[model samples]
Target: MELKSNWSKTGRISQNLLALTLLLLPLVFLLLVVLLPLWTMLQQTDPESYHMVWQDDFMRRQLGWTTIQAGISTFITLLLGVPVAWFITRIQFRGREWVLRLIMLPFVMPTLVAAMGILALFGAQGMLWRGWDDTPYLLLYGNVFFNLPVMVRAAYQGLCQVPANRLYAAQTLGANIWQRFVRVEWPQMRPWLSGAMCLVFIYCFSGFGLALLLGGERYGTLEVQIYQLIAYELDMAQAGVLVVWALSITLIAGLLYAVISKRTTFKATVQVLPPKTPSAGQKLGLALALVLLLLCCAMPILALGWRAISAGSSWQVLLEEDTWQALFNTIRFTVLAMALALLLGFCHAALAHRWAWVRSITFLPFMASPVCVSFGLLLCYPDYTASLSMLIATYALLAYPFITKDVLAAWDSLPVQYEQAARTLGAKNWQVLLFVTLPLLRPALQRGLALAAATCVGEFAATLFLSRPEWQTLTTLIYHYLGIAGQDNYDRAMVLTLILMLVAILIFSLLEWCTARKEKSLC
Candidate 1:
């Protein structure tokens, strides 16, 4: 009996050590990559720089504009996304599944590509309209283009959670469609929609590439100003002040999202309603929604293709040594960054399952924009600023949260009995985790990894800030093309943007396919 007790105690000790290791791995990575750099940047900042930034009217206006635009974008996205998501959910139509899948394309698109797409359709040289000016309207359009799908998907998922039986009961009680939605569906969907809006706001507020490319001097966000201060003016102190403000606002928004998400934990319901054939009015509404969605999301991609094709010799750039080198760098960096992100995400998600507070820590990366993160890395590790390791780490920091957030959600939704049953049959903790928990979490892991991969592949701000000339990725190359004069450069930029878009899409598709195959084999 004493020997058995000793064995049990030893097992407990080993389990505690393993748990501690998992907890410390992610925390230490965050400490080294995120916290330490931030601290270093703060230490290097001049105290008077804060006062200078505060006194500057331009800086103050940028801050206000950032907030205002983010608010406006979020409001418009909600208004448009909810109705479209409802239409997609309630009505059966041709190509419905494809529509759902393709809508996510905009969210994963590189900012430069998205910016180019907007320009192709609506800029000064816009193909559709020649009268358009560079305004906040362009920036707003870009924001909606990128974020509308996110809101739609979130609302769709929330709507899916509503039991069909509840809707039936509401209808039987003589509740109209609007009343059914307001009383039965709205309460459930509110949490998901609200959480998605917070994320959209953060993305818009801290966005660097779109603002830099589209928002001219008068309309640029604080992020663009920070880039100007650091890159052009060599004023790290002033940039630090702006970074602090951006971080504070984004941190608050991220925290609100985390709180709302946690408070409204959703479980899978077995009684979801299947899509019904649409009535004549419903069909008309669905048609209108699809047309608007296609125009908003798909036209940008079409415009880019046409622009590239019209450029003629632009396609020839693909054969250049520089183009191939950038492509290789892009792929290599994405692979390395994705590996690190997966490690950090897995550890963080596993730990968060045990302690809910750990989940909030995943939001830390979202608080700082990619440009800010790269700047902090540059300030903190001056020697390593040009190193491949630093560049990969920056990409990982900006991406791992996507994987962590998704996995954490999956963890919350996962049933507990499977693990309990495994343990009852004498399976050890590690065995249960490997054999039981992981298989069930595959779908979430695939989604997270796909997002992480797309993020690393499409990363623009960090690469621009941290990479050397030799380390240029496709995004940086596209930016370079944009900076040069003449029609050839413009054409080259369009062609390269198309290539970059293809790379991102292929990576996402490949990951999804691989995961799907793995699930089939396991089954």
Candidate 2:
């Protein structure tokens, strides 16, 4: 019996090891394409050169301004985001669905394309620019534009999970609105507030495209410096240091955020929730919420659509065969990215179950500054003519954490007996996966893939590094137009920007419809 138990333990270890190895395969590909080159650059580059870049007064000032801008934007996004979240979740409102979607809009837009839209609205020569001050406040407006919605969604998700009975019971117990909110609502929402603030801070501080387009060489960060050193200065050492330095700062900040943000929940006194039904006041509040959603979403999108239509662009530029080809390229990248993300996500979920060690790695390129990761790839693959293989690899690296985390969450929610029952019924492993596992996981897989495709379509920072002129995708083209100062530059950028955003919205709408149909069928 002892010998049999020892064999069972070894068999279990072997099974877990197999899952871990499979899960790690994609990351290994990333190491070959992304991390290996990074290690080489760091080891080969001279340490002495970093001091030279640091010692320059102008460089130091630029660094200071960059840090200050990012910090300010982070704080502002949090301030604005928390209130919107609180209102949306706690207060009853109309058109809440529209508001939720609007908040997720910026999250889907590629940072560069979003930057173009923001530029058209608020840059030095932007439509809203009045020359009121020498420096435009792109840092603030741009930050709020992208970061606010993110905070809303995260915080709102947290708020929605709270028990409503607690608030109402507090009201019944002679507590005023202020007391009810302070004691019942605020205490429960502490987790989300901390997490959302930390997440928003991480995004703004490490943002690459907004900082680049808005800064106008006036500000430089560890992210921007990574690109400049490679493109302008050709200093691998400085570029390497910047990458390592940015990673360190972000890692430290993330660690601190996670530590501080974790909320301790005691497993006791479960609060029963009442049936949810909105009141007249809630209806009025919802109407106002819908108006706010329209204001936030409609203008920028309408601006882009108008530009695409009446920006004086030639029919050839608008409807040529190349335009069709470019659309194909975009779809191709989107599909491939989703596929890779799904595979990685599935593996991550499986391995995370069996091995605690597997949960430790977070090399999602999207989470970090895309410029840093892509440039690391750029140093190795200079001749990036076609994005087929190179871009797929990059997309997989970036989309991994998002797809994996969501899938893992959904998978863990399921019962283990489902798999075991199939296995006992004369089903081989592959057969079980095909018949039992895949179908059970279909909904989450669909949702994850939709998100991955949307994310890949808007990706530009890394593309900026890896894209060559010959086969440059739509996003890189949009970035090129935005960067060049000329007549109709903004106009043309707007044209492509509208196309990209529409593509994402259409895909998102389709997913929503599909999910709705699935729910209705079950009902």
Candidate 3:
């Protein structure tokens, strides 16, 4: 018994040391990679840069248009997303799960790939709008296509919390479907809708690839303009000014979203009836909405696939050595990024679990633009801009918040009884974590890793900002092909887009399958 007590004491010391190390490592990394760089950029920025941006008509217009476009996109998404959410949550239908999953495609797809797919479907040679010159329309379409799912998922989850008994009571009181929804359902869903709109607005506003590709010069967002300033104009001070402005806007929006999200709490468990079958009018409404959503979400992907197959000799591009090298580099970077993300996420989540204040540090990156982050890193370490290590670090840092969020959610969901039981059985803290806690967190870890990998695979802004010509990923290659004039180049870009989509889908599926298998084994 004395020996066991001594062993436990030693284990406690070792575990404390490990926890401290884990906590400090990520904090130091963020300081060096994220905070320090931004500080350096800020110090170097000319105060007059802000004045210049304010005085420039084009800059003011760009800021105005950015907010306008995001607002428009949010409105459109909510307009379309609410009905679909209601259908999925309140009404029964075949293939419902598949439809929900299909909407998630854009979430995993890289922005560059999504942009390319959109171009393929609406560009000069596009089937629907061949020879059209409507850049704003295209940009709006792309934003909606990508951001609609966020609203749909949030609204669906919120609507699911509505009690069936309340609805039944309303029905017995002669309240019609519309009346029940307006009186009982809308109140519960309002907070979620507001939060979702804020999130979608931020996403669309800060979007780099889609704004760059689809918005063109006439319709550039502040993010696109910042990238152009740094990459094309080499105007670091101006970029710094824009970064400050953009970060301020995003931070305010993020704070609003947090406040709204905090108020969206529901009961942990609610007794709800099974979804009701739709009446004929309801059925028709759902069918129409589903079809419209499919066209917006799936048609671009189908068009890309169709173009890849139909464009003869475009397949020959894959035979080139450079193409293969880019593909290999992409996979390598993605794997390394995902691994680093998982490690950092684990450390951050562990620390946050012990001390909730640590969670605030993880959100700092979300408020800053990726373009700004990459450019800040470049400014601080000019010599390492082209380095593979830099690329991996950029991807990992950008994805760290997402991984941390997932892991933290899963950690919070776990019951404390398991750890207590392990402790009662003479298990040390490290042993409890390694054997009891981590095993239970496998599903979340896998999900986080998969998401990080997919994000890295499609990451273009940071990659483009830091990568050298020799270190081009598939995304850069697609950018190159699209910049050149020719049907053949466009077709090749389409093919590469298809490849990226397939790769992302495969990773998502594999991780989900592994998580499912692990859960089944435990059961």
Candidate 4:
């Protein structure tokens, strides 16, 4: 029997209307949160304005710069990230588990905070190399500093599904290492590679804080230009133009990705053998590991903790009344957004389990950028004044893709055998779900929640746009400090950043511990 909630007006209306309402829920939010604002911007523009912005020499030059920088960043991140991802996943190391944790360290930090880490490592005041006296080759280095880990981690996990037996069989057939990989591994992993590349490209294109903080805005991407227009020139028209271009490119890429992703979604059924231990003779591997650790983790720690701490931080920054207020707002928005995301993810996973078409359709919003999402929200609700409630709702809509995709990924991993076993015991569907399936899915649920929280905590771009003056959060506070400008402001930014990160990591760790407890309890 299909259970209907009392909230539905009538049973028949409930049947059709509830389905309609539920179907429209994500759409309504997406429309109001993303599409409406976009339309508003489009409506405000004249064809002439579009032509002017598109034709302006400054805009054109910057657009060219954006393209060139994104291209370089994408290539370099891939070059470095792919190798690191491969090394970590395919080999055993002294601290592989720790390295995985370190890899995830980036996602927890706000983009600005991450850029700060990179800056401390390689900036103008970079402790190791103070001089920016590098050739053209090093231009990509700063962007790649943040982007590489993103690509490597995505690709490594996705590519791990390649069957080891197949690779072994090819090697036994007189194939050398490179030949074996080409013949046996590359074919199956192309989809994951493509997906990883697409993700990396989108991130590099949209990246703002990193380009500003690390690259010093000399190499501006779409995001930097959008910020420059809005903050510096006070020009909405130019901001609108850059935003629309970003939207067009991102949406097109997203649609292509959806088509590609749909094909590989079925490959979820494939399982791999337990990993064989990595062999010795890894001098090359150790060198690589040390370099990555230093660049990604070690330098940042020294820079932020060592230099910034003494330079200006007092207890006043951490305990300021405004700091506490920002913390509260951050927590409130994160929780509210996470709750909505959880609901949407639950519905999508349930629906996708039965229908592939609905699965594909729900995925379109996943590709939408924060700019587009916020723009849509701005349009759909022209009455939308900046309030805590509305901002949280917008954040929720922004988080839906991450929630839905992560949950769906986890859902796809579950086998039907457990449910079948429950059914054979004469359990009904609801009983089977309540007693059997939910328990099995606890880990994925927890993991999704952790990622969602982490994402919300670090989220800056959309929030920056949506935020009213009163809705200051940690990342916003950091931006506020940046706006004030100077060496003195760094400590304030770092203090809030460090606090924000600690909260996120605490939540993630607790969730993980709970997951482990469930496993032991089940065993």
Winning candidate number (lDDT)? 1
Q: How many angstroms is residue 227 displaced in model 4 relative to the true structure, after the best TM-score fit? A: 3.3
Residue-level lDDT tens digits of model 3 in 1-523: 9999999999888878877887778888899888889888888788767777668999889888998998999999999999988887777899886776566677778898788778878887786776544569889999988988888888987887788899899999999989999999999889989988888988888899999888987998999988988888998888889888887788888777756755565453566657888999989988988887887788877877888888788988889998998898889889888888888998988887787567656566666778988988988888787788888899999787778876776787687889999999999778998999999888878877777788888889998888888888899998999999998998888888888888888988788779768878988
Ranking by lDDT: 1, 3, 4, 2
Q: Number of clashing pairs, model 2? A: 2
lDDT of 3 at 17: 87
- Candidate 3 — worst ten consecutive residues by lDDT sum? 261-270
Alpha carbon RMSD to native, model 1 = 2.3
- Model 4, 300-403: lDDT tens per residue? 65566654556554446876888888888888888888989887776776676667776655655555666556655655565765656677876776566666
> Comparing candidate 1 with candidate 4, which one achieves the higher TM-score?
1
Model 3 lDDT vs. the true structure?
A: 0.83
Which digits, one per residue and each the tens of the lDDT, describe model 1 over residues 1-523?
A: 9999999999899998977887679899889888999898889877667766568888888899999999999999999999999999999999997887677888898888899998999987788975556578888989998899999999998999899999999999999989999999999899999899999999999998889888888889999999889889998778898888888899899899888878556676548878999999999999999987987788888999889889887789999999999999999999999999998998999888888788788788987889778888888888897898999888999899989888888888878888999999999888998999988888779989998898899899988888999998999999999999988999999999999999999988887777767767867
Q: lDDT per model, in order? A: 0.88, 0.66, 0.83, 0.67
- lDDT for each residue of candidate 2 in 1-523, tens digit (9 for 90 to 100): 9999999999878876886688777567656866676665567567776665478786667556666776787777666666566667765445556666556766776777666766665555466554522353765566677777766776675565567677778889999856876787677666766766666666776887777776566554567766787878987776776676666666665655545433422222345343245568655655665565454534555555655677775324566565666677777777887777777777776766556545545333433567766766666665653356777877777776666655555666667788899989989776787888777666666666666767788777767766556556778777777678875766767777777788987886677567656646645
If both were scored by lDDT, which would come out higher, candidate 1 or candidate 2? 1
Residue 314 in model 4: lDDT: 47
- Ranked candidates (TM-score, high to low): 1, 3, 4, 2
In model 2, how large is the Cα lDDT of residue 146?
74
TM-scores of the models, in the order given: 0.95, 0.84, 0.93, 0.87
